[model samples]
Target: MAEFIKIYPENPNDKEIHKVVEVLRKGGVIIYPSDTIYTLGCDITNYKAMERVAKIKKIKLEKNTFSIVCNDLSHLSDYTKPIETKTFKILKRSFPGPYTFVLPAVNNMPKAFKKRKTVGIRIPNNNITLEIIKQLGNPLVSTSIYDEDEVIEYTTDPELIYEKWERLVDVVVDGGYGGNIASTVVDLSETNPIVIREGKGSIEVL
Candidate 1:
């Protein structure tokens, strides 16, 4: 059975937040709320935890690209190559919101999840999620809480999520229903930014 922890969506209890972080540190997969949607996350560096997330989603390791959730813009450099000044300006204005930028992965990135030397990175504005990342001091491997077929399962109730995917994931952090939407995806691997998918964030700002 998956352990479900209730956390304050805005200002999560410090004790509960610590417990959630402990689970991540131990390589446990957790379902947590993000600015855009609820996500399944684990320490990106933990190969076993990453594998568990992949297995639960029925995603082939070779076919799916995983995203890293950084606590802020400064953390982006840890996982991806340096962003150009112009691009950085644009990102600074729009990030900490619902947007994912695909950039070239840094050389030190873990090979288990790197694909074509690129990775998806984002810094969400959610408090609980951000606090957890800040405490961990590194990004977490994250993906939408959905099936491989691209079906989205959005809910705020922990019991509902537990009843549905209890066996699939290890833990559930019930921060409440994040509005049903995925992050806007931008491929910045090229000189020009391309909007691959438009979700919560508006394109006008990008």
Candidate 2:
């Protein structure tokens, strides 16, 4: 069974944050809240945990296009190639919100994503997730937890998310109710910025 933890969105508890980070450091997968929705995440460096997440999501690791949620832009260049002036400007304007910018990958990423040409990057506006990433000291491998129901696109309630994903993940973080919408996906890998999916993040800056 997964460890169901309640973390306040406004002010996250350090003790609770430590618990989640410990789980992640130990190669455990977690269902945590993001700015837009409930997300499945693990430490990007943990290949075994990445494999577990891929299995739960029914995606092959080699063909995965999973996003990495960074705490800030400090280590952006470490995972991606040099950001062009225009692209950097856009990122500076839209980050710390619900936006996933697809950028060209660096020659050396984590082993699990070594062959990936591009990677999605996110710096969500949620405090709990940010604190968790801060404590973990690295970006998280993230993907939204989508619902199969005809009407609802993404799961909102944390308890329901926990119930559905308990057996599959090691931890389920209850950061209150999540949003039904996802992040706005922008492909900045090319010269012209392309809006792949329009969701919670506003397109005004893009």
Candidate 3:
């Protein structure tokens, strides 16, 4: 059975944060609330854990891509190449919200992202997720917790997720009902930002 943790979205308990970190450190996958939706995350550096999450989500490695959630811009350099000054300015104003930017992947990034030499990065404003990444000191390989048919799975109750994917995942963090909208995805690899998918964040800001 998966361990269920109830985290206060605004002020997560230290003990609960530690438990989530422990699961990630041990190569365990977790279902947690994000700024936009419920997501499945695993230590990006843990290849086995990443593969496990992919299997649980039924994501075909060839067709789907995953995003890496950094705690802040300081950690972005570790996974992706340096951004242009203009692009950096745009991200500065828009990030820490609900947006995912696709950038050229650094060589140090995991093979999963390196396979395409591009990575989607996010720096969410949520405290629970931010603290978890800060504690781990690395990005979490994450994707929306969508069903096999490509429907977003939004459940406020931890028991529901536990009932469905208990054996597949190691833990679930219940942070209340998520917004159920996805992050607005932007392709920053181009000279001009392209709105790939419209979600919670506004593309007009770009």
Best by lDDT: 2
Candidate 2 lDDT over 1-206, as tens digits, reads: 99999989888999999999999999999999988988998999899999998898898998777899999999798899998899999999998999999999999999888888999999999999899999999899998788999999898989998789889999999999999989999999999999999999999998
Q: What tens-digit string does per-residue lDDT give for candidate 3 at 77-128?
A: 8877888998898889988999999988888666666567788989887899
Ranking by TM-score: 2, 3, 1
In model 3, the worst 10-residue window by lDDT is 147-156
Candidate 1 per-residue lDDT, tens place, 1-206, comes to 78888898767898988898888899999998889888888987788888888887788765667788988888777777887887787788888888998888888877566554888888888999999998887789888875333455466456677787778777888887666878999988889889999999888776
Q: Higher lDDT: candidate 1 or 2?
A: 2
RMSD of each: 2.1, 0.8, 2.0
Model 2 ranges off by over 4 Å? none
Off by over 4 Å in 3: 60-64, 148-153
The CA lDDT of each predicted structure is 0.82, 0.92, 0.84
Residue 141's lDDT within candidate 1 is 85
Model 2 / residue 3 / CA error / Å: 0.7
**On TM-score, who's better, 1 or 2?**
2
How far off is residue 183 in model 1, in Å? 0.7
Provide the TM-score for each candidate, comma-separated.
Answer: 0.92, 0.98, 0.92
